[model samples]
Target: MIGSGPALAADGASTETAPAEDVTIVVTGEKQDRTLQQTPSSVAVATGRTIVDQNLISVYDVLDRMANVVVNGNRTSFSIRGIDASNVLGGGDGALASVYLDGAVLPKAALVTGPLDLTDIAQVEVFRGPQSTVQGRNALAGAVIIRTADPSYDWSGRARLLLADKTGERRASAAIGGPIVDGQIAFRLAGEIARSDGLVRNVNAGGDADRRKSETLRGKLLFTPAAVPGLRVVATYMHDRHRRGGLYVELQPPYAPEDRVSTSDLIDVTEVKSDIATLDIGYDLGSGLTLKAVGNYSHIRSHYAYDPDHSADPGQIAVIDDPNKTYQQELRLNVDWNWLQGLIGAYYLRDDNRGYFFGATQNLSLRRLGVDQSLLKLGLPQATVDTVINLYGSGVPIVNSLDQPRVTQNHAAFADFTVPITTRLRLRAGLRYDRESQRRGIDQRVAIDKPLPDPAAYPGLGPIIGQINGLLQATAAAATSYQPERTVRYHAWLPKIGLSYDVMRDMTLSLTARRGYRAGGSGLNQQRGQVFVFNPEFTWNYELALRSAWFDRRLTFNANLYRIDWKDQQVSVQLTPGSAFDKQVINAGRSRLYGLEAEFSARPTATISLGWGAGYSRTKFTDFDVGIGQVLQSAAGNEFPNAPRWTLFGSVTWQHPSGLFANINARYRSAFYQSALVQTHRDIRPLTLANAKLGWQGEHLGAFLIVSNIFNVEKPVTSALDPDGRLRGMVSEPRVMGLSFEGRF
Candidate 1:
């Protein structure tokens, strides 16, 4: 047995058969039900059973198993085939990739402060290339689709309890579903709660520096009325709360320490709460035509407080509050005929993001602003300049109590069609017209909290006291209290074309070309208190794919080769020398990326299975000019940040007739750079991790022992230098051994 059994196909259909190799998997990520071999795109699919069998606890865990995909150490962002989810620019209003839960698109913040735990998921699909024609705006790089289990008409329930060592992690989850009105209505409920003491120790605070706690609850209702022949309705509601401490640990002398520890006096923390609701309705009309409508709404709030200086001294503490809301609606008509299969859809979305910030100033920030240089130019002596800089370090206060809100609205119409030209050949095409508009504003106040020293006390400073006071006032006035609201609009026409050829009964070859784009928007320059707009970036992707099965359908192989040309890329550029706040997003970069991915699965025997996947990607900047202080430098041949050149994953599983099983899986990633700047590029070092599980299965209950990072490999996932000249970074989680009990009723 694999996982709980064979496995449920992507469309919620059971694929259990006499031989696991004979199971046919269906994919629904393209809005159409088709066998994996019949789909013309590059996609990675994992069923709920697979997730459970592999002990994949989070979204990142699942992504790590896929080819050409990488998740940053912090788990806040991911990259697909060399393109990051949050675009390469790193300072933009739109994302390059999108994440969908059920039928609703998640907000960007959700990806950062995630409800990432996999508790009651049904299936997960990762599309490697652009899905712009079908997903609109944010599908320039790729997309992730997650579907939770639907309510079934059978009375069934499942529960799991987990306990782990190292982090002292504990979790409990349960899901139940049954018929409420026999064959007419059904309801399902699921809930999970988890807590962990975290790994990094906070020496100054006397606790874990990165503790975590989370809770999730979800309910779904399904209705299929007998009065209306072919009508199905589903309503879902979900609530989630997650909290975590800081993410970094300080490094001792040589900038490398064997233990995870932090010296901050304050316990940095972030908490997020979210509520989501969705309704989906589908009606079948005569003549093989169907209509569907979906509506979704979500509200989220996040609170974050951290010590920026990360020092024992009470220098600066930062606090931020963000509240967001989104509403989305979509309607589509599906046509399924003998000669043609397609869908036409229209979508609308409105998102409102409101946030406020409050904090004290850090001396390092002033250094970045060149305050000392300004004092020197004002005829102040070096000693006096140093004294003034020290005085202003912790004496400045900044507050943005008023919401700096950004509201965005999107409207799109799209259509995708597949037409059979011959029995073995098919032509597929798609187009999408999208329009996006945004309104944004900023309100901030900066003040001096402590008194400045009298210039009269200094020997030669008395003559320039007025100038020094004027400079101080100007520094405090850099950020304005009010700024006029600005509105910007963007439009894009995305198109895709592909051809799929059935070379043999068990083989398929496909070639495709598609256009993908990220919408343009306005951004605020925090230092100058000014707003600026950037143009949308675009990419043209060409791909070739192959899918084949062999040896009595006992082995499967799939491969994809793709090339992407990117232009008008949005990148952050500094307008002046030595000022971080003077940076703004501009359309002044170009890049090219190419990659290949191959995966294979073999089931030589009824009780044994093996799987492997590998990916190779090459990324380089074709034309890029960035302002480093006052000089504009070119980074023509530099690789994109966080883009690894090679990725490999493999897994093996064995099961016996007596209900005993064992599984082992491992993943490897090559070294990559963490910054795009050629001068500052630092290799993040490669990593390899392995996991194992041993278990016994029965009819209604199962128990398993699992160990992650079995090698106890401890390495830095991310690293950076702090203002105090000490190296700090986040390290990989320590090895953990756990036991789980699963029961079904």
Candidate 2:
């Protein structure tokens, strides 16, 4: 199991994940599944203690602050080693990142964004590189495994309250947990609430409440019957809701004045609710082995909304509503011998996502709006703007809404076995057979509102209708059937065999080769892009790793070299051609990626510990020729979109024998592009920031303070498409601070 301590003891519970439990030599990032000093893979683990100490609530906070993971929007669209995409519409399809809360997967991508309320968390494991052989999803890049502590039969609980003021914002949060029953049941509940005043001010729409207010609640329950000593059942539920104002983008050109972007009037409300219940039955076979089984069920639902430009324009209105639901059932059986262990399992995943979109544009004529310069500027307006909008209708309440349905049912059986031919040599192999039924379609209907009749005399003109009209109808249907279904059976027998050799007492080296995959889906929302289709792809990775400790166990090191061959890499691109159509997800031709990753831990004194993480990646599309080239070097290759080339995440922490505590943490990320196909933004660069904590922990009480962005770096977070094309970025987090107190009864 993953745990915690001083130097090596950091297992599953401890959040510090730093040096482990006081020189315990912790290790969970590798192929052999041993301590950091014993495992031959470069992994990063964060403990619950570290999370609380650092005041991290959501996955975004932890990834951006504690680990070296980078994401777009400063907090979302996660990416490890340049494997992430921009989430322009809030709903991004390139979410290759897999989230495993405990052992069950987080179905929807939005839930992975923010406000996780890091409470009762055991450990967070960040696996680097492809790991299709041992994980649930055949992740394209890697996976993040979050393991929470099990409910203890013993009664134990902790609670905390926090208050903070930064710049012009204030935040508050509180939580509590304890035992539900003597020795058979236990529970934990945690919640957080925070509100802030935004940094940007829109004089056009003034409001100090332009900031966001968020709330979250999480509960954990565990039961172990005395009559059934080995059987334990656990359940978890989480709900998070956030409403933000002033979160608007700008729009320029013929539609509005220069630098005129939407602001505060644009209201955004998003919510997430997740329910999970699991039962584990373990039995002792009475031999050198035991039997363990895990049965899990989880459900998550979320809704996101935003008003692009909050005004009475009647035009320029945009609304989107999405409700995603998922049901997953998985079972696993594990056997452990003296020198060998393995697990066999099967999973059933059902997901359905339904959404509605409404977008309206300026009421002005396309020629006047300058939508197509060739059509209007130089004399082509009729063929350009006039024709498109004329087909859809005009003026207020334009019927430009679409219904999108994405549903999938997939079933697969997979198993991975680890056998030790000797104490130092082992073999790992896995296979999976997947069958999926997928359906996705975009059904659109443009409302045609006939010219309003003369109301003066129309008092007799029957409801906005007039004239030659015994021939006119109240409603006209401009709709079509958009139904598409495809059944697929994916067969992949990913066989992985690695070699491990122990050089010294706590030193090891291993090499592994495995294959990863990306699921196939509908082509695109634009029916025009079906010219030449592409197939779902696969990526094969080869890795060599080393793990060791030296200098009287005071220093630890982990390093790996890997190269990936991505065939049929899927990429998303906008089809605007000469105009701006935003951007979307699509499968690219092919690609290649190679990199070096490493992590280190050192303790020169008894009270001070130092930790470091670094990575270098080169991901490119080797084969993509649609007009770009059969050998396309997209903006993605010139620069990895949303993924930094080099990142460093580390901490210098000091502990006093009298219980005083202090630590400084920082992250540095190299610059990368925001899109895969555009040279539109080449001036973009990377960013570096730091956070510090000062506190005291007593046997019964604790007090602490946190300061974020100590350097107050004016970080320029580049965007794929700013509301105004001239402004390349938006205002980023300037600085933040908070104070908190905790007590144990």
Candidate 3:
């Protein structure tokens, strides 16, 4: 949590110089608006001012520097501590960690891409533990809450432009907000456009890979009529369009050097368009009571295509077209009194998602390559090779297609209360009941355009021709009208209990225990045509925390120690090796995780501020076994995937009275495995990054320059290994320097 104080120039980490006795940081997700010091949990905050100064483009940028948080591969996967929001079995109805935008819960697909621009953002809050009681389902791990800037009565607006080297990236944004009726209503409008040529090169296509362009538009209105006292309504609408080049998978061979600038015959591509609308209403019912309601609707359409072979030859290619729709609503009431405060709420969500995939047969046709090097190596004459090629027409390219449609519904009711047990002690408790139902359907088909000739017509080459044609027919035959649909129902009760005590004049101690749950789902085992249903999983989390301020409110320090025991973990099992559709989801045994985190900010002098934070986590699988009849493999003692052993981050800022400031930040993460197999070769290497910024500000204008990745480290962010030992994955960003200017009126 950010301390209550006058902080240095905002640039990522919190760099506070002197704590202000009157200053307070408010947290809204805790049922009642309370100061960070009053909340008995771990949370991280990044303000709009910090976002602009740090040049943060998305939520991923802000979460990367946070303690005990991991943002993996293409910013699509996120985890807290060692637990990923996306369950291992991939059978959950929703994400374990929920992302809320302006009180509206966003779907998992929206979370994977990015959030709206920060031009209209007020603050970003990250809760670092299970918040099932108040947050409801899918919050077993944690949650990210974002609030947009409110409309102000004063007419004001700002515009900014940015240019960067390395990727030839450019961005422009503008925003304006004012009053529609001096004291009754207000409105805000904002938009941004960003484009990047990208750093990775595709020599084969004579173009850059991963190039991207995006545009966004948003509008908000706040209405507070004088005729209806204590009543307010807020409405928001947003549209976003994004397009990107293919993934740059740099293949590594024993004979070649590392290639960050290369790819094969196919250039992958993707495009997405989304529309979102939300409304929030609140009314003060008087007598320390309030009523609130929130509703949201979203629609998204996306397309993706990529080469599966990753080579110069057109061996295999795949593409997907997906369209999704989601609707959510929540209603709640809060009561606050001298001795007691609490909240009760109910939530509803419905999601409709559909996808279509198309691909060719497994291996490229060899029937057309009768005269290749293999035949030449056999000392066959060129004439004979040509004759053989003429005997067999080009091999058929079987086209296969699959269509999947799914729907899920979630309903939950929850309540939380806090009571003062003594002058210096308090007790808190919460309960939640959730029910989920889901159904999915799949349809597949295969086709080919070629057929074999009669054996009597080509007796001499009948044997070879028969073999090739038979394989093609078999491939087409494998596609069947198999429709597997099942409806799964789940219900669970989640609870939380905690204690808080004010032990000293400026210090507090707290202890909390919470239970988390993720609902189960049904799927078909494609290998054996068998249907299966995996059971839900649960986790118990315990934490002890200390928060304090020192030196006449000039410094602050905080620490947290936590442990979690997970039971009935969902695990994915493969029926056979190298079979894409042959997998099943099942419930495995237990796992354990424990960690410690410490954070501090101090001002040794009035001109300089320093802040540092570190965290260490240990995770292990206590029991795990797999196989049909006997245990073929066990991962009982393996570390969790993508979970680093420890993480360290710090920031320093220097400011001058003349409005000049400079800041620097550094982060380090230890090595960790990328998969549950625990193979040494699959471990991701450790990394350390450094960033710096120099800027100056006036009353209504500001300018700055930033240099990121000073060392120009070309590290691999994620990796994929082929059966033949070829390794390739997405690489980290190279060095980049940017200059920006901003003006307000």
Candidate 4:
């Protein structure tokens, strides 16, 4: 939580002491919207100016610099304190981290992959901790709250373009904001377009089919009038479109990178439209009491169409359709109730998602490649049909070729109150009662009267299908013998509590414990042929934090140590080979996540500004004894996959305070893993990349040159098929260097 007072950027290990500076930033976690320096939690803020300087276009860039967070840009994988292994499905990723754009949630795990354009953003706030108490569900790790530029009765806008050299990727952006009606209403509109010639060339296909193209549009409207002094209405929407090269498994024996080919099986497509409308009503009813009411409604829908990265024949391709949707509404009213200040709020959310995956529905003849004649002439057996179905079901990941839709709903009402125990100590308490439910189901598909094309002429088909079913049926988990739809549901209630105190003249201490639950649903594999249902999981999070500033406010620091005991932990284990989705949810036992984080910002000199933040986390299975036994006992000593043991982000800004001609700024991040498998540790390691910018600014115009990955380093996150190391993922986005320009009158 942010502290409860004015905040000034502090020094390095020591606070900086120049003249007093007045800058107020909204803190996280803490009840009061205090300055960043006063926030009790380890929070980081990326100002709009900073974002512009670095060309930080998406959430990926934001997470990379957050404390203790590990991000793999390939598939847009991320984790904080090594507690993220979120499946790409609709439900939560269990990532322990959440993303909020203008206070609206980003679509599910899949929606966040590609690129996010940063055109008219106001500020980005990150809170690293169990955000359940304030953020609600899907906040197991922490929360990312992005606020875009709201409309202003005052007109404003910007148009910028960039030409890049990373395979010739070109980017252009524009935005406009101002009054829709003078002093009555305001609006802000922004859009971005970018395209690239990929690095890989499928020469056989004629061009680098691995190209990327994206376009984004966003708009906001604000309604406020002198007639309604303390009332304002805000509405916003964002639409994003993207097309990139799909995954192609480099076909090899047992499937390894040695036989790697930049396959183009899937064409990842996404269209996300978010709608948010909020009415903020504030009134002074006399008696030193201020009354306020805030209501919000939000909705999101996204779909993806692409191929798998792990196909036996890297040449094999499939067209898949995955769509996910969510709707949420919130209402809150707080008042200055004399000695006690409090707010009570209620929330409701609905999830409706559907996906259908079927391959070779549009098949091409590959029989001539490695044809087998002798065996085909002999006519092997009846089991051949079953084998083909089995292989067809499991062969392609991500494109599970099944229809499974998961629906979930949540209703909760929460309230927080603060009382002045003394001028030095303020007692705080928050309580929430939530009801969550999740339901999952699947549908199976069939081949159209598909009889073999005279196996006698195709002997190769015999072992192929036979081998397929043989490997698939190996697990009792899926009865490929039967084709039916299955459904499962889960329900739960969660609560939270906390305490805070101002211990000294410039220090504050706090402690909090909370419980968070994610409604469980059925698995996508249920569409494979059988029914498998699992229960929901919950977490009990406990934490302690300290915020302090000394040396006449020159030095400021905050640190937190936390422990979370999670029960019924959800684990995504694939039962079949080559599949990228989780097969089922098991009642995995308890686990613990503990970590420490700190941040320091200061103006070392009248002309220089610096900031540093870092975090270390150790997450492990403490007592994960499944019904069968301990699956993680042997893996106990090993660090959790995807969780980086250490993460660091730092920045330095050299400004002329005197309004000089030249100013430069820079930022960087250390390395982290990209996968959950300990054996593939080498695949994703430490990455050290930097960005620098030189610019000149004045009232009428501004210009700057931003250079990213200044060293032109190739820190490829190794995945052969998709961006994420799921199934057979591949690596993309080599060193991207571009020049950007902007000006205003």
Please tell me which predicted candidate would have the highest lDDT against the true structure: 1
Candidate 2 least-lDDT 10 residues:
467-476
Give the winner by TM-score: 1 or 2: 1
Q: Write the per-residue lDDT of candidate 2 for residues 191-218, one digit (tens) a residue.
A: 6666666554454445442466677666
Q: Give the TM-score (vs. native) of candidate 4.
A: 0.80
Task: Pick the winner on lDDT between candidates 1 and 4.
Answer: 1
Please give each candidate's TM-score. Answer: 0.94, 0.82, 0.88, 0.80
For model 4, the stretches where C-alpha displacement exceeds 4 angstroms are 1-20, 28-32, 85-96, 113-115, 180-182, 247-261, 265-301, 310-315, 354-400, 446-493, 524-528, 550-555, 574-582, 629-633, 657-683, 720-733
| Span of 10 residues, lowest total lDDT, candidate 1 | 10-19
Residue 610 miss distance in model 4 (angstroms): 0.5
Candidate 2, residue 655: Cα displacement in angstroms equals 1.4
- The whole-model lDDT of each prediction reads 0.80, 0.56, 0.72, 0.55
Model 1 agreement with the true structure over 331-390: per-residue lDDT tens digits: 999999989899999999998885544454544345566566666776878987777666
For model 3 the local lDDT of residue 68 reads 84
* Rank ordering of all candidates by lDDT, starting from the highest: 1, 3, 2, 4
- Which lDDT tens digits does candidate 3 get at residues 1-745? 3221243221112222223333345677665777666777787766665565566678877677677877876677688886777764344446789888877677676654544456556667778878887887788888888777667677878788989998788989888888999888998898889999987677776788778888988898889999999998889998888777765566465322235655566677777788889998889999989998989998877777776655554555678777778899989898898898888899998987855344444333343222233355567677755554455443345566677678889899998888899988989889999988888776667676445455457766565456546644654565444677667789999999999899997799999999988888766554344556788889999999888888875677888899989888777766544344456777775789999777776666776667677878888888775544223256688788888878787777676768697778777888878877645654678888888878986667878898888787767777776422367777777779998887777
Write candidate 4's Cα lDDT for 1-745 as tens digits. 1111123221000011112353345543333445664454556676665565456777667667667766654545576666663531123333446676655566544435433456666666777666665667677666777667667675666777777775687878887777768987877788888887766544234456457778778777777777876666666666766666643434333434333344444333434444445444455555545455444454444444443333323444545454556667766666565488766778787766545344433322212111122124347453653444333332323222455566667777777666777776666666666666656555554332233333344466755645433433342134233434444444445555667788888788877777766555455443245455566677887778787776665556777787777777666554432333325556654677888887665655555556667777877666645444213344433456556667767766665644333323333444444433344444465666666666765544556666666666554454443322244544434456666666543
Show where candidate 1 strays beyond 4 Å. Answer: 1-7, 10-22, 254-256, 355-364, 371-402, 453-472, 625-632, 679-681
- lDDT, model 1, position 268: 87
